[model samples]
Target: MPFDEPSQIPRPPRRVAPDDRPVADRLADIRARIDKAATIARRAPAAVTLIAVSKTHPAAAIEPLLTAGQRDFGENRVAEAQEKWPALRERFPDTRLHLIGQLQSNKARDAVALADAIHAVDRSSLVTALSRAMEQEDRRPDCFLQVNIGDEPQKGGCALPDLPALLAEARGADLPVAGLMCLPPAGLEAAPYFALLAKIARDHGLVGLSMGMSDDYETAVTLGATHVRVGSALFGARA
Candidate 1:
C-alpha cells in the first residue's frame, strides 16, 4: 500500500484570558452599545467620538480605562482638572484631556495649560481672556463656543442669537474657534437643539460638535455629534 500523507496541522482559535478582561471587556461593552445606537440612526459607529468623562473619578479609575486604549477624557471643573491633570498626564502622556465644564475668565491661563481643548467658551469676556492667556503662555488651546441651546437662564452658554457676534469677537481676538457645544433642555427631546447647534457650527465653517452626556449620547451621535461627553455611563453612578 502507498504511504499515507500526513494530515495538515489544525490551528486553535484564539482565546481572551480572564486576566485580560477588565479594560478590553469594558471598552467592548461600551462600543457594542454605541454600535447598536448608531445602527438605529443609520450611521456608522465611527461617526461618534466617545469622550470618557473622568471628572471626580480619581486617576485610579482613569488608568484602567487608559490601559484599555481610551485616549480621550473629559473633566467638568477647571479646578479639579487642574489638580488632577499633572499626575494623569505624567502617567498617560499620550492621553487627550478636554475641559468640558463652565470655564471662567479667571481660570483661562491654567485651563490653557491643562486642557488639550476647552468646550465652554461662551462669552466675549472669556474669549478675550483665553486669547490673552494663550498669548502670554505662548500656547493656543483648542476651544468650542458653547451655545445655550435651551436658552435656559440658568445655563452657561451664549444665547442662540448672540452666537454670531460672539464668534465674530472670538475671531477678532485671534481665538481659535474649533466648533460648538451645548446642553439640551432636560426632560425634552435634545435632537432639535443638537441639530440647531450643528447647523450653526456648519454655517460658521466650524466642525466639532460636543454635545450629549451619559443619558443621551446615542441621540447626539445620531444628530452628528463629533464628541459626546459621557461620565456616569463609563464611571458608574456619581457618588
Candidate 2:
C-alpha cells in the first residue's frame, strides 16, 4: 500500500509494547503521519517541515534522531539550547535549531545568534530587540508572529486586536516576518484555531504557518501548517 494514503497511516495497536522504541522508529512514525496528512490535504509532503522539539531533552537522547537524519530541532530556553546544542551541532553541523519558547527582550541577541527560526515574536519590544540583534550580528532568522488565537490570558502571543500593528512594527523594523504561530487553549478542539491562523497568514500574504504539537499535528498539516513542532511524540515522555 502507498505510505501516503490515509489508510496507510498507522493506528495504535490493540496491545502495544512499552514506549521503548528507538528514536529513529518514532521519527519514522511521525514522518509517515505527516506524509499521510499532507496527501489527504492534496499538499506535497516536502512542504511541511517537521521540527522535533528537543526542549528539556538531553543531547544523549537527541543524538539518535540526529543520526537518523532528522535536522530541524526546537528548544524552549536560550540558556539550555546554548549549553547543549553547540557540541551537538559541532558533531552534526547541519542541524537547524528553532527557538520555540517565549523570548525575553534581553535574550534577543543570544536567540538571534543561536536559532535559525524564532517562533515567538509576540511583542513590539521583542521586535525592536530582535531587529537590533540581527543588525549587530548580521544574521536574519525567519520569525513567526505568535497570536493568542483563543484570547487566553496566560499565553505569550499577540492579542488578535493588536496583531496588525505588531506585524507593521516588525516589518518597519526589518524583521523577516515569515508567518504566524499559535497555541490553542488546552483541552479544546484545535482545528478552528489552526484554520484561523492559516487564514491570517493568507490575508497578510505570509507563507509559513507554524502550528500544531504532538497531539494535533496531523490535523495541523491538513489545515496548511508549514511547520509542526512535535516534542513528546518524537522524544518520548520527559521525566
TM-score of each: 0.85, 0.92
Candidate 2 local accuracy as lDDT? Answer: 0.90
Task: Report the C-alpha lDDT of model 2 over 1-239, residue by residue, as the tens digit.
Answer: 11111122333432222467877888899999999999999999999999999999999989999999999999999999999999999999999999999999999999999999999999999999999999999999999999888788888899887888899999999999999999977767778788878888888889999999988899999999999999888877677
> Candidate 1 lDDT, tens digit per residue, 1-239?
11222233332442222333465575767678778887888888887778899999988888888888888899988888877778878878998889998988999999887788999999988988999999888888788999888768999999877888999999899888889999987667666777777778878899889998877777788777888887766777665
Cα-based RMSD of the predictions, in order? Answer: 15.7, 6.9
Query: In model 1, how large is the Cα lDDT of residue 130?
Result: 97
User: Which ranges in model 2 have alpha carbons more than 4 Å from their true place?
Assistant: 1-18
Clash tally, candidates in order: 0, 0
lDDT of 2 at 71: 98
Q: Which pairs of residues clash in candidate 1, taking residues 3 or more apart in a chain or in different chains?
A: none
Query: Could you give me the TM-score of model 2 versus the true structure?
Result: 0.92
